[model samples]
Target: MSLTRLLFTAAASVAVLAAVPAGAHADTGPYRMPPPPFGSPDAPGADRLTVSVVDSGNGNDGTYELECGPAGGSHPDPRAACGRLDELAAAGQDPFAPVPAGTYCTMQYGGSATAHVTGTWHGRSVDASYKLTDGCEISRWNRLTPVLPATAP
Candidate 1:
């Protein structure tokens, strides 16, 4: 290539580089964009779920509607359930997230209880199931304690 053309290309590259602020390449910080209101359960479209249990030895088998923010519904303890959900979210954990695939869980059996939760939480869809079949499953069910009745078989 001609020296003049190569020099022109170099100068153009330098100009482009100089146009960007140095801090642009540096790690300014974690996601600067404001995040969803995980702390505010009362926010619209927050917690509105339905929990259903079948064959649960605890005798709490039945579907119950749950609403948060104002905290109302057929749920026995909307306040407590909402509190648990908010707490988990604030801790950077998704209370309704399923156990990861291939994860090892204890073979111990919790019970025959099986529960399903379906609805929207913090503007996200949730369709989680709970069963007392293994340690991980039991823990997942227990984490939502009041949401899902403390079942035993």
Candidate 2:
């Protein structure tokens, strides 16, 4: 091949290689589900609850819904309090990182209650729980509380 033609072909190949998307460059490996929410169940003054997040990889964003109740009673839907996870992801924020470590009030009589969350993640469903202290005021279900590395499973 002529020197000029050879050089042109090499440069074109390099350019095409560079144009590939970064994510495409690497295999994301197997799709591993995120760890479950971490927190103690109930203490002397602590109420326990579960919080699960389903990472729906669907381009439409994810949803976070919660059902809460007392330690041994029927659970009620508290979806309104849990807010939308997809919205947080859109805002570039960790969707589950604001659930405070305390008690929360039930959506009904403003009574104390525990929390159970269910959502979709990477097209999969997730469910977790949380126990709050007595007389806890669940004004609003913030993002999932920060899970300490030591406590994560």
Candidate 3:
């Protein structure tokens, strides 16, 4: 092949390689989301709030999915929560993990029972606090919200 042709081919190959997806060249390593937070209010007949942790893959950039509901009731899906986590991750913020460590929820159920959640990412943890009120209000269980870093005591 002519020297000019070889050079052009090599440059084209380099550009193609560079355009490949990052995961294709990246090392396939295990990425984990933080554990769920603790704490729940009293309920009737096993009516306890539960939080679940989901691994959203490396695409989430160390974000997590937190789903919660009544202990005996069906739990909410983690996709919405995962989406929220992705947004936070994109903003260069780790919302799933908090500094001090703990689960937090910002849900306000118009009932007597409340649920709280906390998630961890990259060794950090974040929390949300939930409070129940009256009526049948929809509690923010599967939605992703801002997770504030806990202040040092």
Clashes per candidate, residues 3 or more apart or on different chains: 1, 32, 18
Please, what's the RMSD in Å of model 1? Answer: 6.8
Looking at model 1, the pairs that clash are 42-69
Q: Which 10-residue span in candidate 2 carries the lowest summed lDDT?
A: 144-153
TM-score of decoy 3? 0.27
The residue-by-residue lDDT of candidate 2 on 1-153, one tens digit each, is: 999999999999999989986667466666786543332122122222334332212221223223322222121333322223434444555443444566454444322234445443323344544433322322233243321001111
Model 3 C-alpha lDDT per residue in residues 1-153, reported as the tens digit of each score = 999999999999999999987677457666785443322122112212234322222122222234323112233434444445556555655343322334354444433333355543323344544433422122232233322111111
Q: What is the lDDT of residue 88 in candidate 1?
A: 88
Candidate 1 least-lDDT 10 residues: 35-44
TM-scores of all candidate predictions against the true structure: 0.72, 0.26, 0.27
User: lDDT per residue, candidate 1, 21-117, as tens digits?
Assistant: 8778667656675556654444446568999989878668999999988788998888998888878888878888899999999999987788889
Ranking by TM-score: 1, 3, 2
lDDT of each: 0.84, 0.37, 0.38
Better of 1 and 3 by lDDT: 1
